[model samples]
Target: MRRPHPASRPAPQLRIKPPRQLIAESGADLEGHGLRRTMGLFQLVCFGVGAIVGTGIFVGLSDSVAKAGPAVVLSFALAAVTCVFTAFSFAELGGAIPVSGSSYSFAYATLGERTAFLVGWCLLLEYGVSVSAVAVGWSQYLNELLNSLVGWQLPDALSAGPGDGGVVNLPAVVVILLAATLLVRGVRESARATAAMAVLKIGILLLFLAIAFTAFQAGHLSPFATHGAGGVTAGASLAFFSYIGFDAITTAGEEVKNPRKNVPIAIMICIGLVTLLYCAVAVAAIGGLGADAVGDKPAALSLIVNQVTDSTVGGGVIAFGAVVAIASVVLAVMYGQTRILMSMSRDGLVPRVFERVSPKTATPAVNTWIVALVFAVPAAFASLDAVVNLTTIGTLAVMAVVNVAVVALRRSEPELKRSFRVPLYPASPILGVGFCLYLMYGTGWATWLQFAAFLVVGSLVYACYGRSRSRLVAPAAPGA
Candidate 1:
């Protein structure tokens, strides 16, 4: 056979989705394939808030406090800074692309299809497992509320997971199913419910601040940096989990009205509001009760409120608020997971069932149910401690990818019309990636191993299934 000249051969092509195509497809109503745009700025902001203000503040605070003492406030600030950098990247790409896949779409547009599939895989860990973790936290507060109001609570056999000496976490399973039901109804209905819950939870946190501050003592903060810089950094790693939901805002790009403008603005607003609230709550909790008392206590805020006011009524109110707060997180995060899967399915990276939208609801009804049931098993039997670190590491890994995607997109498509831009260009995104790695470093080695194992499975699945089925490689079949 005659050898062909190297220069005459064609360059290998990469499977990258065009940014314009993503935007155009988002607006097209393809029979049962399109999602309705019903959320305005307020609803979008509420959705972000609902997702961001859950178990981290309500239950995980104790773990942070145990590590950093009074300096947990600094930990919150550190995590906020990390999120701010990534949120800027998300805002820019979300405005330009405005698709349902969030970081997965960003990756597909800037990086190649294989990278996008991996990013989507990480998101499954982030949103789906986080829902289970938050549900477990919700069960804790539910018990607190029940005991406070009725002087009775579910027994250990019914209230906790197997890891926690219970047969199943019934409340966790029930809450997840309820959230799935609400999501199947429609985005508008879910938005309204989330908004109402957002307002109620915010008010409850404010009330906690008021009562907690009444007992605030400077003496409580005397030894602020008790465990030093390493402790604060580790606490910040855990605190990063609290900021996970802000990016969930980008996941709603296809379902938000005027997403190009509203998505970016809502992201900025959500981050600023949630950051302030988190720092304030951290300060109030530490100041009201000395660091020693706050450490390693489950439902720390409610417990602090009870102690500060010397009454169970105050604690009960906060507990009830926590139950509401955590439930909203489950709803919002589950919604995000379904949308990401829907986007992946449309690209043929996953099963087609995920992409199917219900004609009557304008929602991925079957997909939502599948997500709920899949995660409910873990919520029923897995321990909260077992899932929290996995979720945090997965979330950090996904955010790092998004930051890299921002830099890549800027270089590849400088002319891309962006409604919002990262302030420092490459520097902002570079720092975002750095911060993510820094936090990931602070996590335990066991978590890194788990994340690594997850990636291996994801890569294998992509090689065996997604790679061959991807639409970029071959057009979808008729009616598919």
Candidate 2:
């Protein structure tokens, strides 16, 4: 008896839609037609620094130092190496696509519709959580500054967020709302403000390195890898959060003139500049303040500067710089988040609320406020580690997708008129994937669990609303 094979049955029809076909159906265009390309290499570097040099440097330096001792320098280098690979992939994709949504747009073009949705979802965690985290970190430094200036400080209960021992993070919330207001005004204004802050931050970091180096003690270098190579790697993973925003320069590709040449140049310049700055600071701090001392204080660099010089002047300068720096971090990250949401709305992943631009401001007013409120509250009181960890995981996930996108695009669309191609093709992207994966593993299991929950919730939302409402799935009437 010949049994009928299961292969004889017809293949089931997929509820899934073709990705490219859907992209063609969506009326929204990715490229900006007439936007100004006013950003020069200097401005672009500032933009990258504005996004990258945030509370992470001001607050996270101590944490990393504590984890890896003098080896923290190696950690920064490890993180920078990982970032360089990802940055190259980003440069190639951003130049080719030049779209509003950075990774989300890339994933849609190469991966598929569902993968695109997932990428956007992960970004929400990256950008949204990070904004809140940065805001909260700002509040701490602000309080520190106030105490140093006056004899008094804000009540701890009022200063902190829900998890940090306070009922609410009033300062963080206020800063977020203020940033939202500024964003509602315009991108140019926001960028200008951010640029000023970036300058102050770089100045502060340089000053710290210079002063710390004056007190450098070679003896502190003894027992360098006290925590071993594994600990140093773990610290590097944590330090990766500091490098989060360099790719943001690419997100502005459509707005830049000569994006092909300028965008790639900006990414390399920005990464190189930041890495040099971080290395200088790390080496100086470890030399001046024993790695053991570095771990004992929250504001390690500032504390070391004060201890080395025994001057209130150093602390004042560092605190003021931190205030300016963190403010810019909030502004830049919120800008990135709103833009991501706008891109998603255009593609029908989320509600049209994300797409609504205020006639008064020409920005996404409602979306800005919504994002501000969501991030502000938690940022006020939660531990910086928790928020930063979430951001790192989300960013790693996005980077992984980008690595795949680079390879897939090459094989699938070999002649897509890419202004920049990631040199060494398969090898570069594979290295990028490996770097991001290693960092992703560094995040503890708790963060992974939270990330998983976020994805599951996002998937449900897409299934219930986004899938059906997708502009590409149900094409509009010809004359509607």
Candidate 3:
């Protein structure tokens, strides 16, 4: 066979498709989905809260407190402000696109297939490690709850992962499987379960607040900014972890009822609820327990509850709540992972099996199970410390891209209907991207290198498979 000239060779799939094409595909293909759009504002808000309120408040507060002392409360405010700019960008994009895949979908419609592939790849790391990390946190609290309530605890061999001197973190795997099973059942049931858990979780935090304030001494907050402005910004960077779940709302657009209007509503509602809850919890814990005492504690919230009440029962209840709260995180993270894969697969970026939704459950059965198994290994055997940092990087990067997507779509498709438009035109998204980049810089260069390596691998995969199989062909198929 004669060798083809370089110019004669078919170019890779890099051309951007018209936004209308993607919109039309959605209109036609979505009608055939097993995915029912039954998720309302409350369920959406619950999903965001369920995902947001747990990991940071329970375990991450210790590190934040150590960095910024009582000023960690201000740290939450700083993070929230950063989140607000990004949230506006998300609201605008989610309202206009009203599709799945989150930034990946939005980026595809605006930035081109290559950039979307990279965004989806980043999300894989973010969601997978996040689920595993939440599972690990749940296991720790579950063990604490057992010891606190029943005066019994699991052996290190069964309770701790290898990173902490154990054969396997069996509890982590169990929790991941449980969350996956719930997700496989369907979104409505999952949302309802999430709402119930959110209520219980909020109740526990409220109880802690009430108890903490009884013993609150202004003296505890003396010398509040121990480490100064640098420390506060560092704490904000770390505290930003809790805000990742608001983006989880963007992933549920297709399943949300009235997504164009409701997605933005849910995003803002979730942001407000999360910011308030986080600030309250941080202040209460620090006010009652003192920053020095709580700074190094692993189960810091429970310890604060114990110190305030001077009873194991009080601590035990808090521990029980921590378990439920982290369980919700596991559920939301796993749910986000499966949905992103479904979106990518539908675009022919992954195996088609991923996009297959179960008619019986109206969920992506195989995708959910696969996501559970993938994260369960890490939860059971690996140290998630390094992997967890990658989620922060991935999240910041994706949020920046989503902001840019809003700008690009505005310029490219001016006539397109947008239920929510970002205020202040280019400035909002520009500021959103700028803030995200600032945070990404704080995540350290090591994480940046890892993110770059991740994109390199994803690009290789795209060249080998995604470009060849991508459904952006003539005579567009449903959701192509």
Candidate 4:
């Protein structure tokens, strides 16, 4: 066999990084990443729920209900099951891979550098657009709350953003900026805010369920399967976006206390908790308000409250919850985006700027700001659904890839210490990959176009930069 000439040799970064090497890099102490390990299981759980239960439930539920009618309850169930399978993959990887890049980091450990770049690129889409989507949801609910409490509404020019019509989404921009400011402060502070928001939003959903049950009518469920199987499938695919944030727990692996144990447990617990809340809310909305009413209602939860009590005061509470939910989601998604970028930077896939952490805050301050800046543009200018489908498509693709990585690692790294393991082995990971692909196909063609375009641009960036600056290439080497 002839070796390639040195002149024709591919760069070292183009080679696969060994799992043990990735693990050793992650296990380093005071590596100057400036990230602090401080989050406990409670905070990790809060981050998961805070990210999982937001815009999808608050602002986007009507979209799902409209797509599937009363069958949206079933849609939520299907989406939840799909998420559970993926969550197991995440659990095992999170326990085994000590990096903070979430799936991006996992892919690097199990797959290779180029694959890791793709995963991180997809994550950038998933997290950044998710933050925008959640912020838009917050704006919608905030408008509802203002109308209910003070009898005022911001006209579409100010409330709606680019694709939605206005020059900019002022409210969404405001909230994104607020979350970025909080992130600039520190991670612990961010977790505290997340916990508070989680508590309030969960209470709000429980309250909606209680009030909705009083007005629940069996007749409203007459045509539970309105759109039949097809609509339910579409709804499930869109509903999958809600669970996008659960895997975010893995991104905090570097910051969480006892990450090997805590990260996996948090991922499962967060998925389970969010699933129950989603199902209950769906049942309450459909049974009490009927599918048609739920679809027509802009503020579904608030409308349910007003229907039960026939008063704006009750609507106010539900609207408040939406506000809190959207705010928390934006914060958590931003956190995930920054951590992934930081991890990529540590590996030299991107500029080192994103990896630098603020010594004072013990957070990736610059990276956090960059993320907020990146998403704020879309939040301010783009329409709500403009980026929603793109987010889902990218996420499903990454999840599918992560599932593949799980199977790959099972055979290649059997001796690695893992605090959590995927039960049922091959079946679970295979199902995870299947579920993600099924949902990806469910996403519309336009979304696939957007996703493809984004990856093309990402590849260009990588070819120009990652090909040269990757950490795998030593500075002393002449051909580095």
Candidate 5:
């Protein structure tokens, strides 16, 4: 018998059922010199490290130190443990799907269209708000570095967002625009830039940790749990958001070579490395400067370095690192946002404009710039705390959903090949979900209100645009 042409076979059983032309169209959009599958485990690991290590270690550390004292080390442990379990679930789904949109796409493929839309909406909140928050933090460092080096500073009104007294945050907007421009160019450039920035920031952290550890004293840790267990949990919840980017390593599923093996390894390895770095830095900073003092100085790392070495060089180095690190964080997070939009557009959950890739770059250029403006404008003037609080809630909610997805997929597709599996089956994912929910509860009433409001907005979007535009809504789905 004559061998059948590749196109003659039905699409994979697990494949999204749309027209063959639609499938081809979607595949074609991803082809060529765009954000193609050029990244391997190393590049992907750097992506995770770049995105996760920056804001958390730099700006957020002081608050965690204040809340838990030296016991912030324990808080890091708690957050890491929680993430590891979720990482396993992410690894399984990421490998099984190997598609764009990360969890949003996974949910759509397995959970259904409506849940997918909700996830996408939550992700928009998660990524968009996070970029705003991180960029604001970056602006602070940029302002500081400029003042120290040139004896000049941007006006407070100009440097911060609306609540911070500025009508608009000019620096945050500039950085967001810069990142958007890079993303629209190509993925390889974006990934390479991320890797370089990750190295500079992590190196600065190591320098600080090494210097601070030398001054570590046992007495500073005396009141390890001064505020008691409640404080530690509260601190853990706040710190939990700092670790948000660990899962970004898995987002490169389609691009990672041998994704099953490489993605899981990269996820676990990056998490372990980042956790160690965070715990060590927390311990050293608390031991040397005292937790209360660190909190008062939001730019604690730079302040501590200046005091320790009695020189501007140390502070300058960290400030430089902060600028690069936060920029990388914005890039990675924004990249994740565009990919989700790309998937949604293809699925007809968002406008077709989001699905259209520029032939020049093979990237969702239009979608990325649109999202950048949407996020950057608010970020320029908004308070960092507000953006962070909202993002934390959305991220934790999605992690909980992912934990459930892991167990459901295990049972529902028992024989399906998975590159990675949660080591302890139901218990691991259950514990992961539990930890995430507990943290979500700790985000306070205000955060919950913000999250609820966003969810309501999401529902309305789904009712209006998503449901009507959804590919599945058509009797025979058309190519996007």
Candidate 6:
């Protein structure tokens, strides 16, 4: 056969990491690249709960209520339904792949290196911005707790960001730094601390529910759909932030024992537990105090508790719980951010510095510190509402990509070992993608523009750095 001219030949296809190769590399004991597997089912579940049950319920609930009124309960339900679909996709992929990169790794195996890089980039926004948003919420609750205990609170100028009439949010920065410190010490220690805090915070929320229910009034639920379907959809977009952490369980795939089995189980359990608590809390808060009263109030849960019981003690307890709850979120989500970067670094998609694991701590010390410092700047100066919306949109986009990836993998790797599978296969993953898109649509156009800008920057980074340096990319000819 005649040789084809180089100019006439088709261009090379996008690089892909074989699923089998990814599996083997994940299992190999590569020096300086290994993450210790210390988490069991209980620890993993705790990590998920720690990440899931925080600012969204304690602080952001008011925002959702403002948009949807008493029907914010329906908003929570809508968001939970979206999450359930995505969670099914995540569970199937996490079990099949069992890698720390989460959706990014799944994309690399099924889609292509370029698609995987974008997914990873989107995750950076999802996780890093989420930490900042959660930290800001923590500051609000911290201020509430301080007032309850000492009859004093931080000035608005000190406790809030520039967009919220504050020059800087000092407490937000402090909490993020504290979480970074714990992460640097080690993952096992962090998981134990998170588990304890997770249990305590759950008890505290239950207490709020118990006390608030005593004052429940059916009349408060009148005119539930204040803003109608549009409001509920918008509220659902914001409420989606509450469920961000369930997939954080998947990000710990490399650090969990029997990951293929444990990761999926933890995810399902976490989602069910979190959704139930969130819906119940929403009902209790709205029932105790009308939606108009709760909407837009800082530390709204604490205020509701105080009003319902005519005492500051209940409010103080809830404030303290919010502080602990939001702190755990910062810790757990930041951990996920560092792990995702570590996986990208290993694939030569990001700088090698991020891949460094401390010998003494078995943690990505440098990566953790860098992420904390970078994200803390936003926590200090950026508006909470802006970051929350941005994070939600980015997360939804990433989840949509994961849903598509699951379908792609099934088609391409039919015989691959999977510890768990999406119940409805094609239909389930298809619905997952549709739900993610629907929620993303509910976000404001400003966020879409911001996301577009982010993707542009990411494309440039991959073009100039990641694409050339990626491990799967073949080297150029010496004299080409």
The best candidate by TM-score is: 1
Clashing residue pairs found in predicted model 6? none
- Error of model 6, residue 97, in angstroms: 0.6
**lDDT rank order:** 1, 6, 4, 3, 2, 5
lDDT of 4 by residue, 274-316 (tens): 9999998888888988888788766888988987899999999
RMSD of each: 1.8, 3.1, 3.1, 3.1, 6.9, 2.9
Candidate 3 lDDT score relative to the true structure: 0.85
Per-residue lDDT of candidate 3, residues 307-390 (tens digit): 778888899999999999999989997898888898888778899889888989889999999999988998998654546678
Q: 1 or 5, which is superior by TM-score?
A: 1
Residue-pair clashes per prediction, in order, are: 0, 2, 0, 2, 5, 0
Name the TM-score of candidate 6.
0.96
lDDT of 1 by residue, 1-480 (tens): 988899999997779998987776666222214787788999999999999899999999988989898999999999999999999999999998888889999999999998999999999888999999999999999999998899899999998998999999999999999999999999999999999999999999999999999999989997889999999999999998888888899889878888889999999999999999999998988898888888868888988988987888999999999999999999999999998999999888999999898989899999999999999999999998898888899999989999999989989999999999999788999999999999998888999999999999999999999999988778788876
Model 1, residue 174: distance off in Å is 0.3
Q: Which runs of model 3 end up more than 4 angstroms from their true locations?
A: 1-14, 28-32, 474-480
Clashing pairs in 3: none
Number of the candidate with higher lDDT, 3 or 6:
6
Q: Give the C-alpha miss distance for residue 189 in model 1, angstroms.
A: 0.6
Candidate 2, 190: how far from true, in Å? 1.1
Worst 10 residues of 1 by lDDT: 24-33
- Per-residue lDDT for 213 in model 1? 95
State each model's CA lDDT, in order: 0.91, 0.79, 0.85, 0.85, 0.78, 0.90
Per residue, candidate 6 scores C-alpha lDDT tens digits across 98-168 of 88888889899999998999999999877888899999999999989999999999999999998999999
**Models sorted by TM-score, best on top:** 1, 6, 4, 3, 2, 5
Q: Where is model 1 more than 4 Å wrong at Cα?
A: 2-12, 28-33
Off by over 4 Å in 5: 1-35, 475-480
